[model samples]
Target: MHYTFSQYYIYVIFVAVMAAFSYLNKLNRTEVFSFFMYAIMLLFAVLRIDTGADYSTYIEMHEEAGKSYFTDLFSFTEPLYFLLLKVLYFFSDDYWLMFAVVAIIIYTILFLAVKKLSIDPALSLLLYIIVAYYFISINQLRQSISLVIFLYSISSIIDKKPGKYYLLNIIGFGFHYSAVMAFLIYPIVNTSFSKKTLTIIFILSIVLSPVIEKLFVTYLGELDTLYTKYFDIEEYMEKNYLALGKVIVPNLILIYSLIKFKSFTRYEYSIFMIYFCSIVYYNIFFGKHIFIRPGMYFEIVTILYIPIFIKKFFDLVTGFIIETLIILYYAFSVTLYGILINGGQGVVPYKLIFSR
Candidate 1:
């Protein structure tokens, strides 16, 4: 497939526009532009073709949906996910239409989630693009949807509603089994772990990564195909893996951010703790491709969290400098060259459905 890095400039331009509106401090225009920016992201997802490696995966799944989309719940496909396929089946056989509808749902939830949780929604959006969190929707449709559903349920986590939180995440798990990893969110966020315990876990995770992988396979590998098929360390070693840039490094910075900024509110602290679990996961599974995928469910929180970190932790001028530094890092390090070098998907050579 032809690949080009030029499509990333679109995101760069979006960030530029977002920064301009943010600095302008015009509530009405900023709100309108924020909505517009999200719409553009949704439209990008809707219009793309073969933008990611997995784009064809969903297309093939949709193509086969007529034969087996409704085979059984949890046996083959998740209920809500299968329903989406079936609904789109009636409208047209083309997967692109289903993709478009999914785009609307995914981006709508994401926009709403960021808008509500983020102190600066536009900055969150900018960070979303910078962090390449949007790749989930463009690439992994089912899990991305599942992830957003669980993200929407963050209120339950903040409100101390374990029953409600797990229920939503269980529903999310139906769509993508990986979301079951989120069950840990309830305990991690709800319970108060000391800095000592947190530090110990983080250190052990890095030092014990390979050991943990072995134990994971030894204990749970046979429990389900999830472990045997996906988490098999042997298979992972053989396949050509793609790097999404030193995934652990950015996360480690979050640890520093957490330590440096101690003024977080209860709500913010809950979010921080939730993300704290993700970093631990990444630290343990950093070098592997499959193992760290689940960690992304937590890493997405960085989009909102980072923006809040900048605003709360720095004065206006310092925040601007910090923000500029981050943007530069994203431009050269994360979003642009990082993804390009890693062969990360969804934002390259910007193909559209219309092109066909």
Candidate 2:
């Protein structure tokens, strides 16, 4: 019923094929290639069973939702997600069918967002896989859906439409409260900072991270709320070193981008600020796991931002080479991280709906 870590190579191989297809048809049929790539990822996600850290947990929630009253279910999960679960439960009590439906929604939006927004849609898709977004999607279904919705709202930010941006974020918050963090985006993007000021703030965020951690534990830890429940100050402070691994790459990118800040187009500048906010959030909550979820709203932009940076950072030939290297590194590092460090976020020994 279960497959080994080697099963994940199926994705790597398919992505390789997708990349080749994209390369070969980039000019004439890029849209077709994009759909093909999205379809394969969609299949992998939809067919998965007993995969992801929350896979079993979600199955349990589905079962509970079927039996519980709607009001009771709302108490357990966000209203929109539970409402969707209840509606799906009405048609068929099958959990796999419900999961498949959710997967479709998530991938459809992600595909559309990348195709519409990314400068290099193919590379964005590859980064989605390599950056662990794919893995995160399978595990954190609600937040993944919310994150994609926020991705769409990036346009509103660029267009200077705060109303549309906040409206989208409010809708996203219905699925996951984490979308509440997304309200910060419009302000972040709109705010202007000189290159000198930006560098100073970035350094201050790093230098003062420990003070921020201590302040959070001292102040926010006292709150008895759903959000604060995950704050294990003692355990996290000990693991403070672990947060570095997550932020280092983004921090490096931010430093590089800041050097060329003045050269950025309006759209690119907005994305850079969003990316910058992600780093600042990570620094502010450096060691804690729960606090960092807010930053994911901004961090997901890396799928788009990295390509933009590559084009800005280097000439065409050099950019292509650098991107290729990034892809290879991400493919290797992310896969091994899943297998060894993450254990697939409980996705290892992957199963299908009919595996049993």
- Candidate No. with top TM-score: 2
User: CA shift at 166, candidate 2, in angstroms?
Assistant: 1.6
Off by over 4 Å in 2: 1-8, 11-29, 70-76, 214-245, 338-341
- Clash count for each candidate, listed in order shown: 0, 0
RMSD of 2: 3.7
Model 1: how far is 212 from its true place, Å?
Answer: 5.3
lDDT of 2 at 124: 80
Estimate, for each residue in 176-295, the C-alpha lDDT of model 2 and write its tens digit.
999988986787678888899889999999888878767766776555334444445455444332343356677877887887676677888888888888888787676565566778
lDDT of 1 by residue, 298-326 (tens): 87787767676777778878888877777
